[model samples]
Target: MAQLSTEVYWHSTEPTEVGPPLDGDASCDVCIVGAGYTGLWAAHFLKQAEPGMSVRVVEAKFAGEGASGMNAGFVQMTAGKVLRRMLWYYGAEKAGGVYRAVARSILEIGRFCRQNGIDAQYENTGILQVATDTKQLARLELQIKRAQRAGVTSFRLLDREQAQERIGSPTVLGALKVSGALLNPYRLVRGLARVVQEQGVLLHEQTPAQTIEKVDGKWRITTPHGTITANEVIVATEAMQGAFPELYARQMPVWNYLLVTEPLTDEQLGRVPWPGREGVANSLSFSTAARLTADNRVLWAGGLWYMFGNRDTDPRHRRNDDAFDKLGASFREFFPQWRDVRFSHGNGGLISWSHSFIPQFGRTDSGMVYGHGYTGSGIAASHTGGKILRDLVLRRKTEFTELAFVTVNQPKFLPAPFGDKGGEFFIWRQRVGDRLPLLLPYKSALAPNRFFARRTGSPERATAGRSSD
Candidate 1:
């Protein structure tokens, strides 16, 4: 195996062109913090809506340097890990609307890429969520039923034989197939940044917003080299939101790891039956997902999720030798035929999670518009979030604004030591859940439930949700 490459596969493959940081003081009609998908999309739509409005995006690092570039690249529609919970929480009608909106956003992303002539290696190969055990199979079946009840007809369940025909994973007992796409995430974000800049949106890289305050009714954002005063500010920093005291208790950041295999030769690729190259993820609490790159490399990710107290954002968190070893081991178990496959790169990034396991969109009394907490699924949903942020900043009560994600009041997470302990316990439960039958004797269902109830603000049961790719 090649030595582990700590850099994200998507970014290391195609580095983005970045501009200088904010110079001196500047003012704009609207300013966005963080140049990831949420920020880029907000800038893109805002500029498109009001061409004359002065819009600016400030980033701590280069665009896509965050989770936007490090994610698994599965452009999916299902917002989080579960659809049943969404239906139960928001009702069938509202849940169906959210699902439809995300589905449309997936298509819109593809359309936008095509219209802008961005070759992000986008492929509508769809998503295949496999179940490796009987327990997981039951969960998959339940999800199918819930989706149907919610009027979501796009997902279809497949048996072992059918799933094997699609992916050739011997451990797959069943699979849930859904319409989605795969793309080179780094290229997509880089392309969007270029397009938005061309539309006259001022994008300043390496300009970290150190402090945000209100001065004379306008929002003032202070950066190391300069300051920006804007009529409105959208905080799209995702996991980094923990840095702000106001948003600290709203999300907990967790690290997710990924590994990419060396490009498979034709004969080696032929050993697997993934003609469609669908994004595949097993139904584990900490799910293992695999996607084929444009160069035929297998991007295998997930399995180990780590969270340190205080929501650490250190880049050193990206290098986890043990996590990489676990990922490689799981890949071999899933595809023994590819046992000889060598990995070319390995990396990890932080993903934010709300107690509700849903994305939150709302404005603060201080007049800041924010949308975040995609859990582990934001590639496509973040596009929808862009629309929500746009509507919120413009103070428009449109369809996007009325969606449950926007209209509903998201529950806050437990504060401090309690939250940290809850997260540690949650991770333990997920690990046990993955080992299921083999570890049944050591598992305590009620203890985890009670612990979560005490630690989480929401009364709803805590479900295992994945971080977005």
Candidate 2:
């Protein structure tokens, strides 16, 4: 096998045009931190809602340099395990409402790409959630039950034969076919940056927000090069939330790794027989996700590693050999027919994770508006979050702002040492449960309790439907 290059495959898809950083003290009606999907989408919707509003976005690096560019490109509806928790906490109505919004966002994303002439390689191919063992199958069945209770019918169950016909994986005992897509996330975010820029939003790349404060009924954000003052600010930094004092306890950054192989030969593709070319993920907490690039290279990503006190910003952790080796082994196991396929790229990045596994979108005590904590499943959800941020900033009680995730108080992780130990335990337990399901089932020890069963009223259920576009 060839040595893996420690570079993100998606970054090479196109040349990045870095915008000029904040030159001096600047002020806008709204200032956004982090130019990833959440921040950029917020800017997009904000401009659409109020065309005259002055919006500015600042990024530590170029756009999509964080999780937006580093993810496995699964435009999926799955928000980690948040849907299940939402069902437990807020019941079917609110949970279903949120799910439908995100589901719509997926189609809207494709539509936006087409309308804006952004070739993000958006494909409407549904995602396949496969089960390799009985425990995982049980998990999928449970998910289907919850989805049904939440008025979702698009998650169709497929037996082993049917699942194999879609993915050609021998280990797939059964699968849940859901509406989603696989696209180049970096391309999408960069395209979004361009669109927002054209809409008169100011984008400053290579400018990191170092200090944020609310003073005299206005928000102030200080970057390395300059300062920005605004009537409202959106802190959309996902994985880097740990850097901020107020957000540090609310989310922890966990390192997730990915490996991509060179383009497969036609014979190799023929051997796999994946006609749908859908993104596939196993039914595990720390599940492996695989997708095909436009160029036919196989991209595989999984494995979660958390550093003590959320030290994921360290550049050294971006290249994890153990994680890459395990991912390569998993690829061979899933596709033994292509056992000789060698990975060309391997990279790792941080994912902002909340304790509840659901995204938290609201303002802080300091009154700075923010939206983040997608838990590694933000592609489509961030679009929904963008609308919510717009509504929040505009002080409008739209359906987006009244969603359960926005209204309910989010659970917080323990501070510092405790959080680090708690995160480590969670990762270890989930991995063990995934590997040894018979011995240690997932919900056996980590089941939700009565404390999280409060029912918050939500908007009417979204119509029972599936993605058409």
Candidate 3:
């Protein structure tokens, strides 16, 4: 049998030419590490805001080599339990503002693609979060109520009948429909890189930031073959930011897996009446998301989140046979009518998970601004993150800076061996939780406990649903 392709379907479809790495010493007004979504969007906004600002982007690999390209492509608005925690920490007013900003970004991304003529297979197919069991249904209902209380009005609860009308998933008891979008992630990131380069932002691929130091009021970034000195530097490396000592204790890199099935024939597609092509996910801790590709294939991901000790980013971790087997079993369980559907691709990527399960943005004492720790959801949020990074670089006290993610002090994870062990333990517990419902067929109507919400100092137990993209 042929081995499953580890390359992500998105990157395989459209390959981008790698730019030359930095050759020697260079200087710029702003230097950004990691040419992924955060860096690319930051550069686009910074140049648009101040056309003459000399912005330079340095990448460890080609653009979109990380999560930006490998993600499942759900531009969702759900921020797990972070919104409820924000309400308690920053009060309802500011917390609501943060929620609105991320929601707006989902639309803004679509607009950006349209204006720039980026054919990234952008679709405004909203997200459908289904409840596979009675316990999950209770969680779904509670989540809708909490979302409304937090000033999110875009979500609507769907009964089983209504959900079945949309997508015939036998496991779906009910669903929460929300406004979200789906797109070709690789195409989007690569297109953004081209657009920014067109705007005169210098980009160097295959250039890794070996070390960073501040000397004479300038931030110096050292790469293997070259160095970049700039008035300001933004570390947007996301999961890979652990290389910096200051950020090491603030985030953990967790591996997220994905699989894409071979294109379904029209007769096979007729078995499931998914005319809307909505981005769909179930209410599991490590949720499973599925969406139809432009070519009629089904892309499913999540349900198994892995973490290697020392937060390693080995390429070998990209393909997990165990994860693929579980995902295939899940696909069959959800749609028994298409039991023989084969997968064409299987891959995984790293997600920077913060201790608080919220994205972090702030400036270090050394004058370097950073943003990461999106947990598993960053596609839409990263656009907002880009705006926040821009405001931080400009040193202007704008609404973006006042958001909870910026104004609050982000909690740190346990150090070193403890951190790694703790992360592994957490993943193991989640896996056990995922399997419990199967062993015990009894379903509970009571809402499940919200551990992250309580840990974040929130009195209300918000729903536990982590969207992946």
Candidate 4:
């Protein structure tokens, strides 16, 4: 019922916001477009891998202005190692390769944070997957069977009491927890960007790449005020890669919202058993919570329900709105005492290629590689995607590098026409799925929710999961 504005909540005390727009031509061996997680981290990783390599990062807005800084911070690494799902779709060995690749990437993200002393406060605590009803539980069980078949031992079932005790949430039947971590996405990006810049990566903010085309010899990206010419160009904007409209066809945009409660003292947090600051996700789609930031800010993120489904000029995501209160309701359901917890509403946007429901990576053309479509769970995958892109850029042909993103591209459904108006169709389902799980709080009670499942085929159905917020 209220306007969710992202701009308002995006402000935070962090590294200096790089000012002014881009002007004058800049040249580098590698040029990255889009300052979000993918682009920013690509620059960082490239610098680390090839210290002397010249890298330039260009952004349409401030570093955190895009979906990178505006996210739910879940990093949602539980159902991770999507290789298993790929195995389901691909084969035993191929899936295993994809699985191992992502597994390595998760560890790599943690390693980067630790090695850089980023103070990301990463928690290796496992993911909690719950099922509120029989059908959903059936899905979870089916997933367990599939995962077990794939030799993924990460999923463990906890009864209602165990889940409640472990997660400090009353409305859970069982949980599947896994080793993962969470952090302030803003802090993660800002910290990593700061460190990367210190190592000599050129980062230009507030400069939109107006046109990206191939010149006589190499790739040249034109901005409103300047141009960047480089041997290689990386387009990592995900759903927001407007510079190349074809990316729009390849991916769809999904909107999610999050809320930051007034700091809960240790006494208040005592109710939650999920410690080590591990982010917790419910059995339903996209429902999750995390203890992030050094000050003990309990960040609760949820919802793929596009609050602004039909607005034209304005984007779907906005900040400091009444919708956050509805999102905070998930927290109250789990930790009832937190119901009274005052919170600041936060908004975030996502660029996802959910039609295929996969993270797209690798060379789209000669010397041009694109890494995107993390949907909303870019926290862990982007790190890997960037690494794979780097490897491909360097012409590395190892198994780990070559097979990272080969097959996930096909079977993707692109909504017809440019800027399909049916975008909210995806959001509608996610909102319904999230509320449905809660509406019917037990495994047997989930019947009413599935009644609506018959109608789901939209792009959002993939990310319509619980929000990373």
Per-residue lDDT tens digits for candidate 3, residues 116-180, read 99988999988888888876665665565566666664445556666787889887877767778
Model 1 agreement with the true structure over 1-469: per-residue lDDT tens digits:
3487776788867856679999899999999999999999999888878899999999998999999988989898663356766776788888878887888898899999999998889998878888787666555545656776777644454556667888998887766677789999999999999999999999999999998988899999999998899999999999999777678888889999999998999999999999789999987878889999999999998886798666678988888888888899999999999999999899888898877777889987677888899888899989999999988888888999988888776888788788888888988987987776632321112132232233234332222222121
Instruction: Write model 2 residue lDDT over 279-388, tens digit each, in one string.
Output: 98887778888899999999998855656454547868888787888888888999999898888999988888878788889988888787878888899999999999
Better candidate by TM-score, 1 or 2: 2
TM-score of each: 0.92, 0.92, 0.92, 0.82
lDDT of each: 0.82, 0.83, 0.83, 0.62
Candidate 4 C-alpha lDDT tens digits along 1-469: 2432344343564555675776698888998988777887778768878999999888777777766776756555425334335665666565555555666666677787888877655555545666554545545545555555555544445555655666666666654455455656676777777777898988888888887788887899998888888999999877665347555456665556677665678777786676545566654555455455557767677554453422221454455355576676666766786766666546645446455456777665444678877766777777767777777778777664656365544444444442455555555665576455334343334542352233234542221221111
Residue pairs clashing, model 1: 72-469, 376-466, 376-467, 376-468, 377-468
Over 4 Å off in model 2, which ranges?
308-310, 437-469
lDDT of 1 at 437: 65
Q: Please give the lDDT score at residue 130 for candidate 1.
A: 83
